[model samples]
Target: MDKLIKGALQFMQEGFNEHKNLFENLKEEQNPHTLFVGCADSRVLPNLITSTLPGELFVVRNIANIIPPYRIKDEYLASTAAIEYALYALKVQNVVICGHSNCGGCKDINQEKAKLLPNVSKWVSQLDEIKQQVDFTLELNHYEGQHGLRSWMIEKANIINSYNNLLTYPNVRQMVEEKKLSIKAWYFLIQTGEIFEYCEENGHFMPLGEKK
Candidate 1:
């Protein structure tokens, strides 16, 4: 905790001074352009990855970047509420669902280790549909790679599932159908610091800057 406090003090001394104008201007209002849904992993820095400033991204980080389907009578819906605020109030143009390599949450699902965590098990069970799809795909293709590849495949599938789940919202669906909103799936390779965007027409994730 002390270390975090010291880091905050240092930010006030150096980082805060450097972005003074950006911070001051944002005090009155903010109009972030993108809603970045990413993992709660300490290593995944969405702003640094995109080179975005304070007011550029409205981010929501959760386990495995999971966004459950929109539900009305749930106990709590942190991710769902954030999605609503970002799309309706903030009016973000793009919704980016980012899944990273070597995600512990993915590993939990792969190994069936969620039973130990009651709440987490319930939350991660949302990926069961993706898990079944990955299993079927691997069986059909006869996958013969390392376990790492299997994990990576699961991560990608989860991102795609999130993209689909976001569209299940009425407002989100309306916006996308009207060309006012776009949902993008992303795979982030932590080791290489590379990002790939999903191309629906190609049914694959390709490097962001590489032309199709």
Candidate 2:
């Protein structure tokens, strides 16, 4: 708590002073171009990874970075509401679904460990269809195999699943069909500091650098 407070104080002093104009304009309103849906993992900092400034990327995060199919119900839905606001209200041009390597949420799904958290277990059950669709060839059987190829495939598959879900929203589908909005899937490798962008044509995630 003290460290957070200290960081807040430092931001008020140094960061605010350095980017006064940017902060001033942001104070009035935000016109972010991208809606970044990602995992609520401490290691994955959206703005830091994208080198984006404040008010640039509107963000919505959740465990496993899952995007549920759009449904209107009496219950409160956090992620769906955020997506609706970003797409319909804010009119963001791009929606990026980012999945990272060694994601705890993905690992949990792979191991079927949601039983440990009752509420989370119920919530993540929505991902069961996708989990079932995951290619068994990508499963890591042995300890040595776990650290190699299979891990990357799991991470990439999760990103693709989320991206597909993003299209399930009626508003998103309409906008995408009209070419007014675009959805992208990304994989961020924490260990190597490399990023891969999904190539729709090739059906593979290639290095961002190679794509450019």
Highest TM-score: give the candidate number.
1
lDDT of each: 0.87, 0.82
Indicate the worst ten consecutive residues by lDDT in candidate 1: 107-116
TM-scores of the models, in the given order?
Answer: 0.92, 0.87
Best by lDDT: 1
What candidate 1 gets wrong by more than 4 Å, as runs, is 109-115, 144-146
lDDT of 1 by residue, 1-212 (tens): 99999999999999999999999999989899999999999989999999999999999999999988877874678888998899889999999999999998876543455556778777888877787777788778888554777788889988988888898886788888898997888899999999999988878999997726
Question: Which regions of candidate 2 fall more than 4 Å away from where they truly are?
Answer: 109-116, 138-150
- Candidate 2: tens digits of C-alpha lDDT, residues 1-212: 99999999999989789999998888878899999999999999999999999898999999888888788999999999999999888899999899898877765443455556777777767656554445455354433445445556666777887788788887677888899998888998898888899997888998986864
Clashes of each: 0, 0
